[model samples]
Target: MTQREKAKQPIEADVVVVGGGPAGINAAIAAGRLGARTVLIERYGFVGGMSTAALVYPWMTFHTVEGKQVIGGIADELVRRLQAIGASPGHVRDTVGFVNTITPYHPEVYKTLAVDMLHEAGVKLIAHSFVDSVAMEGDRIAAVRLTSKSGRLEVRGKVFVDTSGDADLAYLSGAPTLQGRDEDGRTQPMTMKFRMRGVDLAKVKQYMLDNPDEFYRKTPIDELESLPLSGVMGFFKQWNAAQLPINRDQVLFFTGPEPDEVLVNTTRVQGLDGTDVEDLTEAEHLGRKQAQQVADFMIRELPGFERASLSQVGAQIGIRETRRIVGRYTLEAADVVEGRRFDDVIARSGYPIDIHDPSGKGVAASWVKGDGAYDIPYRCLLPQRVNNLLVGGRCISTSHEALATTRLTPSCMATGQAAGAAAALAAEQGLAPGELDVRLLQEALRAEGALLV
Candidate 1:
């Protein structure tokens, strides 16, 4: 800790991406592929932020409402590689006539794949690095200060992508942000996902069919009673009619992973601010205890769990919503519900508006049927009042109601790629992200195999 060291200058790069989640990973990779000296800083040791570390397995929608694969480039390549390794299967047809793509891979697989991709792409990765503050020059982000094992350091970049999910970099850089809803800004409940081993697939399916209401009733849980698994039977019937296999005892239920085995998603703990370290720590403590209670109940009450064993629990609690950067154009619920299209659209999302209540007893979801896809304008990815900064993932600008749908991983990936590509192009050509030609950016994205409409 010499005086010279204390005053050392920050490392500089062409593009710097904070947060190593799906959005950040894709953004960094895209920037690097476009020949930018990209640097990706992550708080955790590994990449794939939520999907791998938090164990949010199974990417939701990769296709448009018409069942055509709309996501490509690194995102699709990763999925294809994982599928080749048997980490995931093909898409599952849902009762609502949508294909739900689930990747039931070990979380470690995602970590490995993500690292391999980043290494091959030549992006410098600094792990165990937590971004603390943003150094700004008026509307432009100058540098980002990070705390790591080595010491506190600063990373300066020409272009910065705020993929921190909570809009940490953007918020600190003086960009306006919206957190949760209302003055208190309450976020959705966080869940701990775990998996169960030796689940009798047959018995689980049967319980859903034969005892729909009773099965949900006897689940021995209160926070999820409002979710009503009994109603899922109708969905199962649709699957059965479509010639999908219906197993009775094999219930991959969402009871929240607990102990050593079950993936629990039932902790309804709320009122904790994800950006606050103390609040997050307390939430983790309560979440772990609640996970244990869920596991115990599943083993004792659920029919297919007579001999089922808990296999693994999530490494991190799955956070649903957080700080959203106020972008140039905030997508709203009306836009999503009406299936609006945009000429400047860079990506589209078809997932439902699934908003988990803070109380954790019920979930609010709006499902769309038949060609109900909404365009994500490029403006939503650009943070307002920032010249060289952009945002993606759950933190992108959108109305509170619209965020319920746009926060999914696939949508995050699409926007991440767009933002990354946009940043690289802007830096390479000495233009601000907002100043870049939309048609040129779109051309570059399409050249990189991104699906844009």
Candidate 2:
């Protein structure tokens, strides 16, 4: 059939979630379980998004530095499911001193389990579909256009939840959005994660002990020896000596469920806009080239990687920052650092402000004050100018500095859970997301085991 001749196939749902990443996955699940007819569209064949596609490993910390679990509900449930199947070792100590705990799992296993959960929740999955445009009725998104195997289709929904980490849905709907840092529109660097197997971790630990000053400053030898599986982020002397082209002052790798495997998150492609196709293409090329360089350096220099082989490279480069919607209320940097509470809080995160340098090497991070948790207000999910739409993930309303903390995997999942529940509630009540009662949303989230104070 001719492209123009083909009819726009229509699918109807109460909540239509775009992007099947960690945020979208939880959003669809929460909405579906809340009795909303949920539809989740993914660009790829699988649903794990960054977790499976980009190989962003060891879901960085669901807890505060004090070991208080700030994220629960669907996020925790996913981990428990993985544990039940022996596909994950669950949360382990962060010997790198970056976070309280890092949850590591097998990427393929994560893909399978995520799909299973979505099906169990009765969320209709549309894989290999890319959202091309949006049909709007005044300020509300009437439907989203999708190009999939069945040909061009239109999905109509009462409420739309954008979990497209890049804010593709909100941006396409003509909503005013913020991109990158405020000063120059430059985003945090993109990383291409790679994995290596056949590593001798014992020798690696011995080297860290012998050269105590070579690793992360906060991590002590005692904590390093406490866990058999720990995230490692040092070997500065070797990294400096090798003079690798890859950016960053130190090398970072994390142990996984596999004894001999380590996920390498070292390659950085700075000064690239993840939203731009050309930039994404260039980033993909540069990131892969840099990944090869890092793997070679590890094998030749690191004590544990003498026999390690580059087993896998990420299907896509890991994007840290992108387009953020200008919602009803923007989360400020101080709110994150001071652990500010909100009267309409829907989600909470203890993960620190971790900014991967936009145009330079290294990262700048600041921890949250008090118990190390801060509120993600419900208003952050309600993008201005859009009546029936809610957003989750890194794209939610936040300043550039605050985005640094909310961009983590666990934080994204938390906001996603909020967005999904809010979408369901709004659809049921026949009201705009802004008109929906924040208290009702909070009650729903709490019943699902979400931690919101």
By TM-score, the best candidate is 2
- Give each model's whole-structure lDDT: 0.74, 0.91
**Per-residue accuracy of model 1 over 302-370 as CA lDDT, tens digit each:** 666778866666777778888998899999887887778899988887777777776544566676554
What are the per-residue Cα lDDT tens digits for candidate 2 across 324-359? Answer: 999999999999999999999999999999988988
Task: Estimate the Cα RMSD of every predicted model relative to the unseen true structure.
Answer: 7.1, 1.6
Q: Looking at model 2, report the run of 10 residues with the lowest lDDT sum.
A: 1-10
